[model samples]
Target: MQLTTFFFVCITNASSTQFWPGFKILLVTVVVLLAVKNYKFLVLVSHALFLMIP
Candidate 1:
């Protein structure tokens, strides 16, 4: 529920500030933080994906 609400808020805010530099930075930071938090899991999944590409 909370995640859905957060996405809704981001969508509404993005519609209005789609070109805002700060928004872009904030989005990048969020993505970076998520990547950092899931670094190991991401690496494992990506490794599996690569192995399947044969």
Candidate 2:
């Protein structure tokens, strides 16, 4: 699940012309949250990634 979130953020960042750095921060945040079993954070990031993607 964490890996999925990381990939989602990475892809979203790669696709965008700007706001990619924010994705990096989001990726890191997701990783930390995954370590702590914060599934809510994962869900939030996933939705954010979905919104960012085309």
Candidate 3:
């Protein structure tokens, strides 16, 4: 499930030509922290809203 969320988030940006490098870096950092912190529930739901980020 986490992998799915991560994949979607990354793929969403993958097609963009003007994506900001720092934004992607920050998102990866945040996702890692969320995973490390054991916030599974949040990580699950966040993806729904994450899809709307752009």
Candidate 4:
């Protein structure tokens, strides 16, 4: 919920060309924080998601 709100705020505040780089940085920061807090769960979820793809 908070992440979604933050993403929308970032989107609205930035131009198109700036959005991707900012989003990538935001995404990496989030993933690192999540990984630190739940390393095993994060890995398992990612693997499950990978397998679900065709």
**Top-TM-score candidate index:** 3
Model 1 regions lying over 4 Å from their true place: 1-18, 40-54
Best of the two (3, 4) by TM-score? 3
Instruction: Score candidate 2 by TM-score against the native.
Output: 0.37
Question: What clash count goes with each model?
Answer: 0, 0, 0, 0
Which residue runs of candidate 4 sit more than 4 Å off their true CA positions?
1-19, 41-54
Instruction: Work out the TM-score per prediction.
Output: 0.38, 0.37, 0.40, 0.39
Q: Which stretch of 10 consecutive residues in model 4 shows the poorest summed lDDT? A: 7-16
Compose the digit string of candidate 3's lDDT tens values, residues 1-54: 766566555646643546677876676666566657666735653664466466
Any runs in candidate 2 off by more than 4 Å, and if so which?
A: 1-36
Task: Report the C-alpha displacement of residue 15, candidate 4, in angstroms.
Answer: 20
Candidate 2 or 3, higher TM-score?
Answer: 3
For all candidates in order, the CA lDDT equals 0.50, 0.62, 0.59, 0.51
Off by over 4 Å in 3: 1-11, 14-17, 39-54
Tens-place lDDT per residue, model 2, 1-54, is 666666666656555756558766766575556646766765765676566657
Considering summed lDDT, which 10 consecutive residues are worst modelled in model 3?
8-17
The residue-by-residue lDDT of candidate 4 on 21-53, one tens digit each, is 766567546655665676664664365334434
